[model samples]
Target: MSASSPTVPETDPVASGRPFGAVDVTWLALLGLTLLTWIVGDDAALGLGRSALLLMGLATLKAVLIAAVFMELARRGRMLLLGLGAYLVVLWLVLWLILARG
Candidate 1:
């Protein structure tokens, strides 16, 4: 590569001139939420069913966050977001049906 070519450095964002992006903030928030969810979901006082539901809800939230931020669904056209939402709804319905049977 030529010296003049733009090089993507592996430095931290704080060191780089670029400001922190929304995706970075969303990722960090998701990480914290994941940790908190695990702690709360694992608490013995909540009981198995409630804990499982809480974990499941957290998982769903994480999935949505990843889709919106990392996948750039938030900036994408409404139709694309709608399609993704529909797909997720279908997946959730199928998963619910399967889990309900057990």
Candidate 2:
């Protein structure tokens, strides 16, 4: 009610309705990733190191999907977006180093 404070409209784009198909697709992708992780469990075909790498990569991909679509973090916040990018890079690098070591 303060004159100085800015008020956001109820029709903000973020709050607007989204096409239902997009949500369906995101849900399917999440389910597929879950099945993939389960399928990769205790498999010797790729060996231990490579399997670990593959699993970690899938995990990162899943995280990105959830963050971007489910959490809707992709809509705004530049610094937060940059943080997600940095997180993915640092995560892979750490995994790569560990693989190299062991």
Candidate 3:
């Protein structure tokens, strides 16, 4: 209540109407994906081609999640996000082609 100290607004997370934001959700999703990736790695029944493809797909999903949430691309970089989406599509296509040919 000092005259020199300004009182801040009540804008804490809960007061803001959303306790868990996008970042929290994204983090949980990433953790789940990591666990799934480990499980896929440890499984011995899947052939190399299937395993590699699954791993690659999981990696790409993680990459997109990180970029959109951690990098704040979803808020300020629409063009960059689009470009990244395109690049990932192309990358996946090439990987699939290579894996299929082998």
Question: Ten consecutive residues with minimal summed lDDT in candidate 3?
Answer: 6-15
Candidate 2 ranges beyond 4 A from true positions:
1-21
lDDT of 1: 0.72
Which prediction has more favorable lDDT, 1 or 2?
2
Writing each residue's lDDT as its tens digit, candidate 3 over 1-102 gives 679963533543445676777789899999999999999989989877788788878888898888888887876687998899778867876796688567
TM-score-sorted candidate list, best first: 3, 2, 1
Of candidate 2, the 10-residue stretch with the lowest lDDT total is: 6-15
Residue-level lDDT tens digits of model 2 in 14-102:
45655454457888998999899888966768776777787888888888777776766765455676689679867976886688567
Between 1 and 3, whose TM-score is larger? Answer: 3
True-structure Cα RMSD, model 1: 7.5
Provide the overall lDDT of each model, using Cα atoms, as 2-decimal numbers.
0.72, 0.73, 0.81
RMSD of each: 7.5, 4.4, 7.5
Alpha-carbon runs more than 4 Å astray in model 1: 1-18, 89-102
Per-residue lDDT of model 1, residues 19-45, tens digit only: 777778998999998898979866989
Give the higher-lDDT candidate: 2 or 3: 3
